[model samples]
Target: MRLAELQGWIVNILRRGSVLAAGGLMGAALAAPQAAQANLHQRYRHVVRIHERLGGIASPAASGPLAPGIDWIVMDAATGRILSEHNAYNERFPASLTKLMTLDLAFHALSHGRLNANTPLPVSPAAASVQPVKLNLVAGQTVTVMQAMLGMTTLSANDAATALGQYLGGGSIRRVAAEMTARAHALGMERSEFRNPSGLPNPNQVTDAYDMAILARHLLLDYPQYRYLFSVPSFRFEGRTIPNIDGMLKRYNGAIGMKTGYTDLARFNLVTAAVRNGHMLIGVEMHAPSWIVAYNRMTQLLDAGFAAESGAPTTVIATATSPQPRAAMPPPPVRQPAAAPVLVASRSRTAPVHMIVARSVGHVTRDMIPGWTAQVGAYDSYILAKRQALTIRGERKVGIARVGSAVVHRHRIWRAQIAGLDHNDANLVCSAMRRAHQSCFIIPPSNESLAMR
Candidate 1:
């Protein structure tokens, strides 16, 4: 063929190839969005089912007048199947029940020869300073690891926890906390995190009923030898006697002691295990309105579990099957924007207004600080700002600022910025604040802004 003929053919081929590639690209572009939408829809369904089966949303009993304020979860100890759950995954402070993980690590150390039950653990100044409900160990004093374990499990001793943490962690409390968190994750307590060895009131120290249940189950199943520690009625150590805080040990039949914890944020949490007719059940409740309420709720859970077992046919040894695996689903789609805020035209109708103040340093996260009021004001100097900031160190931040031509004084601000948080997350943060008795407001930054004079 002539050069001109060959060139014409090559151009034709190139044009056809371009057309095919463009068509393929268009097809992919069209298909991708639909696929994403479909995946999102599937995920929504999965979440709904999870909420329903897990009872993480609203409980059936919550509608009744006698509904307990505590969030309760009960599960078959053998199979790890949830038997009855109410707010099973509702997040709450773990309190001293945090020691369960601490004890778990101690046991691991024993197993690994890093430490033994009879190992002498020295109480440091840090350990002796941990707040009350303690064994009252003095700094530089020594106690066996086993004694500390008993003190922690039976008496919920903060001092003992500190000593044990120091001993097991080789003198660094931070390392112990890190190991505790890592172990919690290894045990699949996904909803839980630990910041301290003892369940002190750290805002970051938090766990949920589901996660507690998981930990309790592991303790009962994986570490049966340590089970007796939970049942001790009292511990007498260092010239002080402390009684176990778990009421179920005395009140409930077949009750096995696990752990009890309380804090303003956690509001009384308990993990109780019971064995009835060879069937073991574990119950967890967090944020109960009162200690008595927590006890009653666990009792009810145990009764229900026993009743279910009794109803099952004997000799057949029927096992509760694991719940069906739900399909893998994507998370809920991004919510559409809300309707524009209504502007009232009538004199009687007023626009809803919100006020915010800076939080202080050392103030528990908005979720943990209770009964906090914001300081409103405009400031002119960094010195004033710094002083105000120091005052609310743990509760809020103080800074110089002006809002809409108003000279605000000593305004408190949140140091942490939650940028682009979704509605659910925002609501969660708000709820946490309310639970902790702190005040919070959502503020939208202005497109145009100016520094305060």
Candidate 2:
């Protein structure tokens, strides 16, 4: 036996000298010393149980279930403090609400300049095949990224969900779904596991009310610029005008558009948010028996939370419209004119590195000029590659004149480079760039030109 175990036995024997004849107790101590420690762990659990399960319900369960097995929560959107919850962490099917993560990834690309709203997204047979609650896209038909977002949001289009996943995953739906799960973990949605982008009936997919509230909060706060995407009442696409199905957006007084879902298994899932008097509350209801029950319960919770005179001072209500009934969709995205910001070179200490602005869509072409090149990073796809190059170019406007892509090891990759420079200039540029904490390497610029030729 280990020294510690032996000491425990001796202490037990000394404490109960007359009980030595009860050899069973001694044997139990020797064979199951861990049982004693387990009690201590139980005590420890009681102490630590005072804290929450990280991002979880913080308020009292003031009310009971609206219906059997219904999970719901009301959270202060700004502080993310749970004002009220009921079975909030019980795992349940999410229905079409899975598109939130897919849309989250799309917005990430948009804000990072990796995707433009107008970028044409092709619909593959797999993407087109997602049934019911779908956009009915045909194989090989295409829609812009914004159009897809509209379809997904206003109509809960499963096809749009699949298309966005494929577009973001670079033609791999499974990879995008995996990315969604990883992103959910990173966001601290501990009770969520998504199997598909459209939240279809998958035995493996599940999430709870607490996790949905977390996602709803992030969707509102993280990308406020894209908040406009969620609220449109109707969108005219092709020949049909698709109307948003979110009843909260239609009827709730202060409600903004969030999402809605329904399946025999998931059964009336809705995530709704509202703002009144500079206060916001997000409500999530999953697996309600009927849509009426879900919305009524949600309305009751939101009404109580909003009416609570708790005077919470940490929250700033989002000022965007509730995405309620609105007539025309927002205008199509137009390219903003490039700022003509001049780059004042810092002290040129022999070798100077400069980050250049990306050329505007209408800028002068540098494709004809080619020599050696130096770049910072390689991208997995040409679109992402070009986007990164454009980002740095637009932000700093330095040595980046041309961004190019090549298939390396059978995988398409993009390189951020200072093109059109001679060998000496390229080396100098790379050395200077390295000083700025950017890794750089020179590419055979002439070889790329020849290959393109």
Candidate 3:
């Protein structure tokens, strides 16, 4: 079967609850030993073509059942105070989020005058042949340091990132990866290891939420001047406008840019930073089941972190009218044998590195299956209702807050509710809100009033 047919067949089988069969067929058809082995060196590519065809609109989840690993954390970017976390130190694949370290090295090189933004770097055959979500860089062509970085930030281009690695490594990608890992260690990412520059599906390459959060904080703090590159929504590459894959940049109100990563093994990973009311928050999530879940949960984490930090109800609310992000669907990864653990250690630097710990706000995890909603209050405007819901959600640190409308007496009114909670969760949240003298009521799974946006 063709790639498209293979994708469709996998989806159909998965929907029918035959994950094992799909995996079996996929292994037989696509995971041939030779090809799989070759891919280990080529790395993978982003599905940029499909992403463009969809006009940057995120389609519904298409990857099979959710990938198993789930790790996340949210923290104050400036103060290093972790608001919440779960399994923050567990090792998981970092995928293309590895480019953040690559970019870190790039920024460091630029700062020390070791590399110039306009410096010409030659692309190798190795860089040109990596998988999709790429710029299709030709081996003989040369891309400037800025162009390569832009390609990485916007398209998550494997070719661009590889070429960057080769340049920084003096024509060696492995050397650059070692340097990346070394820098990560200096920044206090002890549990992480970097085997490749582009987070292709290397079994040995790994990291955790805590390590990623620390890396993100360093990127923001260490390279304030180059931070604008992360926020570049799109860039002109070879006459094509390549958009950033991190949809939160357009979907969430205060979202700045960080990075997004995925692979069959790694699932969906994201590190997001945003500024609201002058406070910057950094969030990291790993191995989310799908792209939609990854973005939604990241937004929830950031919202809750902001709400907790503000020490008051949040006034800003993200409405449905905000730009809907178009999702990119990469072709499924070929299965590979699990990799053995590889330990990585970096030489210590003189610069002091402080580790940030979670501030004990109870385990803050996404209510991935919210079966009940607690209605806080409704207001004249949708924004007001959403604001109230967000405030309550942050204050309570539970459920996904959202706004839906109702037509009452022929006049449309908005409803503010926190969804993604079960029966006991709903009751507990409502009781807490009631204790605080706030209006609180529970809407059952079948409640007509719980029309979420």
Candidate number with greatest lDDT: 3
Q: What are the per-residue Cα lDDT tens digits for candidate 2 across 248-298?
A: 664577677688886655777889988776567789989876666777788
Give candidate 3's error at residue 451 in angstroms. Answer: 27
| lDDT per residue (tens digit) for residues 49-135 in model 1 | 233333233323332111246667777776665666665654567889999999999877787788877789889999887765566
Off by over 4 Å in 1: 1-68, 312-453
What are the runs in model 3 whose C-alpha is more than 4 Å off?
1-69, 313-453
**lDDT scores in order:** 0.59, 0.62, 0.67
Clashes of 2: 9
**Comparing candidate 1 with candidate 2, which one achieves the higher lDDT?**
2
TM-score of 2: 0.56
lDDT of 3 by residue, 1-453 (tens): 379866774564345345323443454443344243433322111111122233333323333223355778876666555667765645677989999999999999999999998999999999988765567688989999998998888667788999999999999978998998988766666557898889986655778786788788777766777776776655666654455556677568867768988775677789999888767888999988766678788888888888877786654332222322233332232122132112101112221111111111221111112246678887888777867776766676555566667688888887777765546768888898888898989877554224432
TM-score of 3: 0.56
Model 3, position 23, has a per-residue lDDT of 40
TM-score of candidate 1 relative to the true fold: 0.57
For each candidate, give its TM-score against the true structure. 0.57, 0.56, 0.56
